[model samples]
Target: MSLTSTEKCAAAEELIAGGKLEDAEFLLEQVLDSHPLNVTALNAKCGLLMRSGKMAEAKRLLQIASDIAPEDPVVLTNLANVALLENRIGDAIDSLEQAHGARPDYLAAILLLGQVHQMLGQRKEAAEWLTRASALQAEDPDVLAAGAAFELDQQNIVEARRLYEKAVETRPDHIRSLAGLARIRCLAGDFDKAVELAKKAHLLAPQDPESALVLAQVFFQSGALGDADKLIGRFKRRYADYAPIVLLGAEIRIAQGEVQQGLADVAAWFRKAPGDAARLVAFLKLLGKAGDWQRILDMCEKLPAEVRASDAVVSLQEEALLALGRTKEGWQSWARRRNLSGESPCPPVQVTLPPRAPLLDEMVLMRFVDAVARNGRLEVSGETQIPGMWERLSAAASVDWAREAAPDPQLLADLAARATLHAPENGGFRAYLAPEPGRRAMWEAALPSDGRPRVGVFWDARPPGLLIDHLQDALQDLNIHIISLQFDESRHQLRTWRGVLDAGVKLEGPGDLVNLVDCLDLVVGPDGVPLHVAGALGRRGIALLQENHEWYWAGSDRQSIWYPDVERIVLPIGPSWAGAKPALRETLERIVPALHLPVTT
Candidate 1:
């Protein structure tokens, strides 16, 4: 039997919903041919075009439908969808808003508007639209779940939890609501509940990557490496091209000591999305950890000029050059750290110091020098005997102790242009300051002769986040003599480890801190002044880093340009230090073997 135009349009929608796009398109075209002004047929044809990835044709059909029925909410909403697909965000927003204005209670338009606002990073507007949608459809599971997801994005945890719970209550098997709740629980460190919720969501939709990702993250963060690995393997098989899954898998593999495999995974991810700066930096870091200096330099050189000149890329390049023992090239690259604004120009100034005067004011002068010194134009009067002076001096300009020259017009012009003029580029800067004879003699005399390794320890950095007690307890079993290099607020932690420390070493009022640090076999501590001092004095050290560390600790590379001999042990991302314990233990084990100390315990 033949069907009427309206009947054919209805049949087309059923066909489209049943996944028969070709049949639906043919039916919709016949309906539109007979009834060109039929908004329903026009909208259906636009949906079919969109589903088939013919965005331009979809938009044209949507426009025709909108013209035929200017006040039709469905036609307006479909047009907005077409606009969004085309990346015309502003047009999508305008269309959606107009649809909502035409029919204030249209739940679909309200929901779409909420999503579009969220996509534009307008969370407040998204919340308003979502709230209105919820009001319009009080029992809609999708609306409740979307509202909960929006709350989660805004970090309104308590409200998000409430909304997600309500959504689950309304529809027990809502996958997104369950996943939303699971994410909150995971972030709150309630891994057990998070696992339970995520598992339930995964069971409901086993192939859903979002649910699986949440579950995998919960497992990894809870230290269930085996479960996380299994989940990651499944995800890789199911969604091989998924970037987050690939990155997470790489991290898990690296943490499991499959360094080469993990590195390969990271490189593969970068190849897939080469323009992602964060991932590119991550790949370069993995290459560095593998000690592939040649590859690091080569990969860096091959990067687009803009990417190569970025701060992160430049920093990695500097580290690779320094690691390869190319000091001059490394220093030249390191000078790129100066991010200058062209608006203001400051002329290079050579501060002349009277004899018997301090070379530069330690407190105020260093800050200014660090900010303005470029290319080597900021010259000092002469070399000073001050113990910590050389380190700061080298950062600005190389000292010409014997042949002093006046600051010329060329130097001033270079400084005015904010050119790289740091003196370290001259290749003659000393790594450590020359300590006074008396201070050096005192430190040498106080050196420990106990056949055991002398390890310097500093347990604090102003905003404290160190595992001091745990570190002290762990060190108690090692056969090494501890020297406390702590000063200022760090001195308080000394009482906590006094029982295990040797009483012969005098830490109180020890003058010339650099000379003292230079005498130690190795320094180990969190990011702090003592670590910096050790690095400056050309001493070997171990730096304990938190996940959110200073910019100097760029990438996963253990090497630092400021402290070439220092190795970094970065803690995993989390609120607690539990994840870091294993890495710390492994580092200590490596250090003991390198120091030629027998494994005592």
Candidate 2:
């Protein structure tokens, strides 16, 4: 039935309040058709547009309302809300200031302004407003909830948990407080605690899309994939209009290796929520992983001009272009990533061919130095480590004989110092020593009076980024007592070491690590816990290094600055990309002779 203008406006406000935004927008459009200057209808329409996520249209409607009633606190607050949604954080702060100035005790504007500052990475500014809001209303659930979010962002997990618990105590049905607590517990590896909080949140806000999303994430993280799938299905059926549930369900399906099925599932979500930037980027990344570059290119062509120009879409487009071997276009687009606005341009690395020779000479080293000077820094195997730095200098010396410079002892010492103390590139930087009380006493008891070569043996520990299968083979040949510093049941693998050295020892977590360092004759591992601990303790150890790992292990060459008493067993790479397998027989044959070499004066 056609209604009067006043009746239509009231009906729109009722629908908006009920969260039926589509219905509200429809009614507002009909009412605004005749009474174009109806500020109340316009304000309600702006809010409906916001709920629908049509931020541009929301801003337009709010602007019209502001034009009609320029000084209205309500209209100004609505404008600020739209600005916050669009991430115009500074503008949101200004708009909120104006709105609150007109209405001094406006709680909503003050709270949202604080949240905007928090999102902008202005932690101090956010805390100020949040503190003010809390002072104004100590028991307000929303104020307490925002404060908890601020604390969580700062990584003060203890304070965040306390604040969230207080928020829930004050308002038992506060969904934000419940979800925040659940997320923190999940991060701390307490899945059981997280599940309990999530269940409570789901019960309180049964119809809220965010609650269902949080529950699904908690279930997924806890390895209850089936329960997550069921919750997603139930949420979809109940809140068929909700788009986030469908998107999250698709994400879960992708994680579970049902990529094709997940794509089909999210098609409806894309239809309902067109131009979802995050979803579109995620879909492209999935396609890239599956080697579907052609399909990604098709999507790029079909995307709207504005969406294509978006930072996420543009970065994806560039990646697709590069992967498709469009090198010229790819490099041209790469210019966008470079800070070319600076006064001086950064030069590219100069490559000097090494005449396909067996031995790299002083001239070759000179060319390597020139290349490093040109490029600003040398990268070791595409990683910014010292070995990479030396290799580039080696390359520069290859071209120009005059550029060659012998190793400067002082410079070498400084580089080694920096690499030991500051280089976290390969998790090798360990400047601080751990104090091991019990282990140190145990080691003191076992210490030989004559000081026959002390060797520390760490057998069953896997270092980060090592292939576990490879470490097992390497362990069999080394003649050393196996000490297990692993937190898990890898001690069974100590059979090989036991066969060689005839002794086995087990060390617990950090404590065992500290004690093991005190008693070892020489520490040996395929670069595991003992390696870092021994290095930090300034102990002598032999590092069995993987071929490509020399850069990360020793910083430069096969010598370590962190542990001066250490010798590296490196598998030197030859011409081809084939494995750098060391001749173990030859290595063992030379080890005794090399160790017997008189200390170079």
- The models' CA-based lDDT, in order, is 0.65, 0.57
Q: Which candidate is the best by lDDT?
A: 1
Winner by TM-score:
2
lDDT tens digits, residue span 214-293, model 1: 88877877767678889888777644544567767876665555657877877776776566675688778766655566
Model 1: residues with Cα > 4 Å off, grouped in runs: 1-197, 200-204, 263-297, 303-339, 342-601
lDDT of candidate 2 over 153-263, digit per residue (tens): 877778889999998898776888998999899877688899999988877655445667788889877667678888888766644534456666765665555657777
lDDT of 2 at 73: 72
